[model samples]
Target: MEHAKPLLNYIRKHVTLSEEEEVFLCSKIDYRKYLKGQYILQQGDISTTQCFILSGCTKMFFVDNDGQEHIVMFSIEDWWTSDLGSFVSQTPSDFNVQCLEASEVIQFPYETIESLFEGIPKLERFFRKIIEQAFVASQKRIIQNFSLSAKERYQLFHSKYPQIEQRIPQYMLASYLGFTKEFLSKVKKELLKP
Candidate 1:
């Protein structure tokens, strides 16, 4: 189906799948669409499915005790998103994953994904690599937050994901970088100066 290609391509990048394995994987996944402002997963709910973006963007964030929304990450096409802790443990999620644009995703239900590893042994290796990469990225972000200045962080984010800056709002981007909106504006202004 149309929704399967991106995910298959992504999986191929990590591990090769046989034709039978590909068909088996596709049969187990569900293709879904979300409208702008709709939530794929919400805070306080168990994240039973992991969504792999086929198109559009989403932001994963949580509301603090004061009701402030703190963005954790913004995801676009080709990214896999879910509350990892909640999905893995079958516990309530601490974050909300909301679509920022009309979007399509391939949903891999937790049980189905687990079962796939048994039927298609290579999938276990693929998933393990995906988790390891995600963990490493999380570690890198923590280090950067502590060591990099706001301006430096902004520059690095921009350089790495130039496309994302154009898709998301400034305030959301600022939040992901651990900077206040006003601070982000000042940083942008400073960068623009000769």
Candidate 2:
């Protein structure tokens, strides 16, 4: 219940919810604690739930044919994480969602979400807005990857997610920026200079 407060507040930012509605919403949520390095969702598994981070961080990534891991996104406290394609289609996920730290999350099953949307129409709008934001962010990331230099990408990442930079390892940050660890180190050195 206490963990639900952050999620409730986040939803309230998009729509007003009565006390009864809030209680109903919270009742459907399931809580889980994940140890560091645990996988919440793995490649090839159907993603049946969307998760809200109550505390700690997670990385969503995929392994390539050459067996290199590509970091797609990082979700931290108060953020939502899911493989949207798999979640909506009930298909196997290509991405793996793994805990970067011992973490707590509140999960909503896809079936429960559908029931909520039908019973509480306003929630449909809330989720729509959340998806819209996610889409815009994804588009921005794509554009940045194609148009921005590695140094520029690193700078933008640092500016946008300073807290995450402190929490995650430099190699993960480098991967997210589509740069080698050596390149990221060079960028950091340049950034430190006057």
Candidate 3:
């Protein structure tokens, strides 16, 4: 299916765009598909594209000094994926973006987004708002990390993205929640008990 409507509506909700402008913005993006486990980006690569997840799931994570994976974010259907700092600064990415399931996404080059901002000033405002929301969510996640217990963190995550929680894998969820697999299983059992 053409995810055009959902994508267009996502944009329209943030800023009004003429038919011509919508099509113009859409024209620059390349729609592509990836199998589960495919890597959209890897460490040390200068990422030049920002992806809009149209279907399935994707995750962004980094391997630390000890080579343990720490998930930064999970992008489900309709979410955007990219290492923002790297993409904006044209620097090598520290994280890896991997498809967690067969996925379809719209990939737009950084320059295209820059040009879109120039042509549609409202887009700049829309993205600024997006960045603000991202920042707020990041702060909330950090607070939750320190203040909430593992079970509470899992519950809060469910509250925020029940649908996403259902769709992704438990290990990935465990990684995101900063819990061991067995601990997450215990948490799930607690949640499942009547």
Write model 1 residue lDDT over 2-86, tens digit each, in one string.
6799999999998999999999999999999999999999999999998899999999999999998899888999998999999
- Candidate 2, residue 60: the lDDT equals 99
Q: Return the TM-score for candidate 1, rounded to 2 decimals.
A: 0.98
Q: Output the TM-score of candidate 2.
A: 0.98
**Model 1: how far is 69 from its true place, Å?**
0.9
TM-score, model 3 to reference: 0.93
For model 2, which pairs clash? none
Better of 1 and 3 by lDDT: 1
For 1-194, candidate 3 gives per-residue lDDT tens digits of: 26566677787888898888887778777788999999999988988998888898999999999989999899988788988899999999999999989999888798788888888788889889878988898899999999999999999988989988888888889999998889999998998999
CA lDDT, candidate 2, residue 96: 99
Instruction: Judging by TM-score, tell me the better candidate of 2 and 3.
Output: 2
User: How many clashes show up in model 2?
Assistant: 0
Give the C-alpha miss distance for residue 88 in model 2, angstroms.
0.2
Model 3, residue 6: what's the lDDT?
65
